[model samples]
Target: MNPLLQASPLPLFDQIQPEHIEPALDTLLRQAEDALSTVTAAEFPATWQAIAAELDVATEKLGVAWGSVSHLNAVADTPELRAAYNTCLPKVTEFWTRLGADERLYAKYKAIAPESLNTEQRQAHKNALRNFVLGGADLQGAERERFAAIQEQMAALSQLFSEHTLDATDAFSYYATREELTGVPDDVVQGARNAAQAEGKEGYKLTLKMPCYLPVMQFAKSSALRGTLYRAYVTRASDQAEDTAKQFDNTDTMRSILTLRKEEAALLGYPNFGALSVVTKMADSPTAVIRFLRDLAAKARPYGQQDVADMRAFAAEHLGLTDPQAWDWPYIGEKLKEARYSFSEQEVKQYFTLPKVLAGLFKIVETLFDVEITPDTAPVWNPNVSFYRLERVGPQGR
Candidate 1:
């Protein structure tokens, strides 16, 4: 989740205050557990139809609830909610792994005749079986235990990675005086001024946030200032200024997981993890994936090189530099674009206020899909909230 869910249309559980989440999640988890228990206790051999229909009820409810909470944890972040959600994710993941790896559950699901299911139901069972196998449902004794440990560690490490990224994002602050703001555009200067005023500070404030930091790099004439911002932005994820950099201690964790996965693939009689992973993917093989990437890379390489060469020429002529470093790219590129097109991105940004851009996008979608979008008259949450319901029309005027 990216701490910016303020702009999203979807409901968010993490932003709904701590008191609300526990009760909702508890109720939802209980409902899912009860459904799964009932399905497991049924005496008759499990058919795909019965299992698919029953499983969807439990998983779907849990999915919607967890999706909202996890999404909010990433975007519209709260420290307390992030802690609670991180605590809950392991339990939820373990539950899913256990349920999928359950021998009785797999027996019931695997017993169903393929032909007995409708297309969707058939696909559901196929997916269920696929997940079961992935969860080490078919493995026994040592291999299964190994797989479980691998999964648990991987989940923890992934969470750590995200937590570190968030920490890095929230760490730095930028302040500049009016004199320092000389080369910045008026709106950008105003934005920085507003930010500083918000914090009751004397001058402009900027941070790693794209909205604030990017404009200064793109338009600010001070090479030193641009270099400073660029360095801060790039180094944010390192251990120096970030508390969450501990999350990236996952190098060992990932290697351990990958090693176990490769072993698991071998036990299941696949050559490697890639072979195991792509079994259900469209590309079908690692060779196909590599070929696709290399082909696309080759096609783009010439154009990309030319762009680099043109930029180097422009920089050499204007800035008297033989080679342009990372910090020089944006400032130089802005000049080059203006030199060629007589148009600048900062100048064009006035017509693209967030609301107007959104409205124009909605208009385009409406034209293509023959749908209308209108704001909700009243809402429970934010005053900025909007709701839309879509309906598809028939071909004839019925």
Candidate 2:
């Protein structure tokens, strides 16, 4: 049996292979389609529980299974896993598009009386009705068809964007001599050396991964080395990248995504995507959101300008950098922080071990919420992940 088909509460991550994806999704999608048909039939009653029991249960299983696949693809990507995900992407997108825009299902949801529902159910029912409109259920003929096509295109483009960025980040590496590493933290330099040795290469291996990149920006004394890494970091998956790296450029992908989003918004009677987006959110309209942001910026702009001015003065007087470039800001900021607080970031980091931090956090939460939290076992994609269970503390201590 496919591990994805197992009736476990949590995913069997260790057992779920790329090969299991197609068969598992095929079965789950078929079940969800059948459930949709069952619920939307004219003979079916327009009640929440009845519709939920048949449709919701099936769809929830599909959601969990697909979510597991997506999570693995994000955290532990491989060529085989990526191929499977891309192959199944369109099918999943198509099913969701069709389900959301199904007029029959929309009608059934519309007929569900709000008064018949409890407080939570009524809120969910209200959200469902709004989502139906936003999902293009109100569109007819060519417009509806175009909306569905747009959704599939957007999903494909989004996945492609992520792939391009990931590939670009993984592709580039720079080896620096010990002298070039200069003031960079010892642990980071040692890790880079270990990485180079593992690959049988010379010098310290440096990549765009945050762990190596951030410390170099903060503490490295070699400005030229920092500039090299900074340029590569900013140019990843863009047309501005080096010629060899241009294959992963997202220039056309980004343009296509924007165009489709605009078309999608228009099809649903929204002036722009932002207007359409806020319909389900707390903000009243796009104008209101924009106004709020502008007001916030106006209030914060003075302090921001003062900070920039202070950084500039400090850089000129202390660091001898009269004209600081984009790459120099983080280094300058770190220096300024050390001078002001009389403590380096690395100094503070030594006291907060992961185990101690988590233990303290758990104690605080348990005290505040009157709950007991315990470590629990589950299959995880990697050893770094942990699972926990929470239980309410009863008066009898049961």
Candidate 3:
């Protein structure tokens, strides 16, 4: 049996596998298409309940199933799972595009009487009408088709860019000797040593993962090591990655994505992509956002410039580093903080172990909200992930 076909409140991550993705997606897509057909039929009742019961239930199921696959691809990606996700992504994208473009479905949503609905239904109806207009539901033949095509293409390109970035990040590993790791924190060094030992290699292994990369940049004594790792980190998904063969360049992908977004907005009668984005968001207008950002930047620029100058002066006078570059920023910050404040970030980090932090956080939340949260070992996609459940406690609660 396909585990994905089994209905549950949450995904059965314990049973889901890469092999199940394609079949599950195909079945769910078919079901969703059939549901839309029912909802859009000529004789279908133009009522919220009719639409919700027939179409919304099927759509939610499809979303949940597909969401599980995509989430797993992000958190626990292997070659097989990645392949399956990439293969199914287009089909999923196409289904949503087709549904959104179905003028009949949009009309069905429009045909419902707002006065007949409860508050929730009325709110949903208002949103549905606005979204239909935004979705180009009223557009003529060629334009509507183009709009759907843009959505499908953009979805594919966005997924590709993300995959390439992740693959590029996972492709490089830097091995460092004990001497090169001087001034690095004990925990970071131990983690790096463990990484190398995991592969039966000697010395420390560093990667672009934030936990290792950030610490090394801030504390490693070797300027060469910091500069090399920083360059590799920033140039990920570009041609400049250390693993040249696995560059996973996103330059073309990003260009295509931006072009498509602009075209999509123009097709919908919006001046630009930013204008289209703000339609569904809280922002009033693109110009408003731009002005706000500019004003905020103007206010912060003075303090920011002074910060840079202070750091540059300190680095020159105390560290014997007359010149500093992009890679030197974190190292300088760490040194400056210690010299000025007599405290190091590593010292702070050591006192707050992961378990201690989580326990303290849970205590704070429980006290503040009068609720409970506990670890739920209900099979997560990644072993490192922790799932928790929250529930209200009544006066007689145990």
Task: Identify the candidate with maximal lDDT.
Answer: 2
- Candidate 1, residue 374: CA error in Å? 3.7
Question: 1-398, model 2: which lDDT tens digit per residue?
Answer: 89999999899998989999989999999999999999999999999999999999999999999999999999999999999999899999999999998999999999998889999999999889888888889999999999999999999999999999999999999999999999899999999999999999999999999999999999988888989999999999999999789999999999999999999998988899998888888999999999999999999999999999999999999989899988988999999999887879899888988888888999999999999889999999888899999888979783
Q: In candidate 2, how many Å is residue 31 off? A: 0.4
Instruction: Flag clash pairs in model 3.
Output: none
Which tens-of-lDDT digit does each residue in 79-192 have in candidate 1? 788877876777677767777787778777878888888899888889878888877789899877776766776777777767766676677777987876666788788988
The candidate that achieves the highest TM-score relative to the unseen native structure: 2
**Model 3, range 69-163, lDDT digits (tens) per residue?**
88888888888999999899889988887777688998888889889999988988898888888877878889988888888899888888888
Stretches of candidate 1 off by over 4 Å are 1-15, 239-271, 367-372, 377-387, 396-398
Question: 1 or 3, which is superior by TM-score?
Answer: 3
The TM-score values for the models, in the order shown, are: 0.84, 0.96, 0.94
Q: Tell me the whole-model lDDT of each prediction, alpha carbons only.
A: 0.73, 0.94, 0.89
